[model samples]
Target: MAKTNAEKQKLYRENLLKNKSKYDQMRKISRIRDNKRKKVERINNKQSSSYKSHQSFGKTVKRVLQSLPKDIHKCVSVVHHIAQEFNIIPKTTSHHQREQHSLSIELKQLVMNFYSQDDISYHLREAHQLFLIEHDHTDAYLSLGSFSDLRPS
Candidate 1:
């Protein structure tokens, strides 16, 4: 009877060892399920923020203009106010000029973002700021600053 019990215990241990990979697979599946649930929760939280749209200033302006009747000045005035507030520096003939200025500012902004702290030094950054100031891009630079809270280095 003792010999039979010992043989049975040995067989049980072997069976558990043989099924170890199956146990690992189940653990992996469970972890994947939990991670997927957490990811969904994170996405839901992000969707609750005010940043619902991803668009350029030019596109946003175009959208606002299109939404209003073509003959109205009040809505245009509101758009102009938004443009001025953003420091696009609205002027007479702004319907044409605003697009050009905004495009130019956006281009300069792309160039600025190309420079990073790792590649640029103090002196070069100062020179770049001075150049922008001379080129009448101080407003554009400030607008960029407003986006990321960046300051002259």
Candidate 2:
């Protein structure tokens, strides 16, 4: 036979308290794990994000710089071709001097070949900054504890 209504209430209260204690323990454990996981994720996220742009820029600059020597060689070949056609080799000009002079002339001509000087300079400046940052050589950290820190840029 079923218990009286008063007895059922007492049983219900006892079960509720037991389950409540278990639930509270579970909640505490879940909170601790969640906080730990979040802390670890936050640290990893910061490490990955901080150097991403710097790394990207650094890679691009390195690639561009690497190809530069090849481009310079090509330019030198072109200058040699032109000089040979005109028979204009100087007796005093060493091979190094010839290369240097040709490079200077080629650079000037190439700058003119561009649509504008500002465009080339802008790209060069950005590439240079990326190269610097990528090398982990940004001097801004030096300014952090220096007098420059106090001055407004």
Best by TM-score: 2
Tens-digit lDDT track of model 2 for 1-153:
989999998887677668988767767898999999999998886753434588787888688557544677786776676677777864334456432212244433433444143443433435333333543533332222232222223
Identify the runs in model 1 with alpha carbons over 4 angstroms from their true place: 1-25, 33-48, 51-71, 86-153
- Reference-based lDDT, each prediction: 0.61, 0.54
lDDT of 1 by residue, 44-124 (tens): 877543545656555776886688767668777777777788889755643454333333556455445645445655445
- Model 1 is weakest, by summed lDDT over 10 consecutive residues, at 143-152
What TM-score, to 2 decimals, does candidate 1 have? 0.22
Query: TM-score of every model?
Result: 0.22, 0.22
How many clashes in each structure? 0, 0
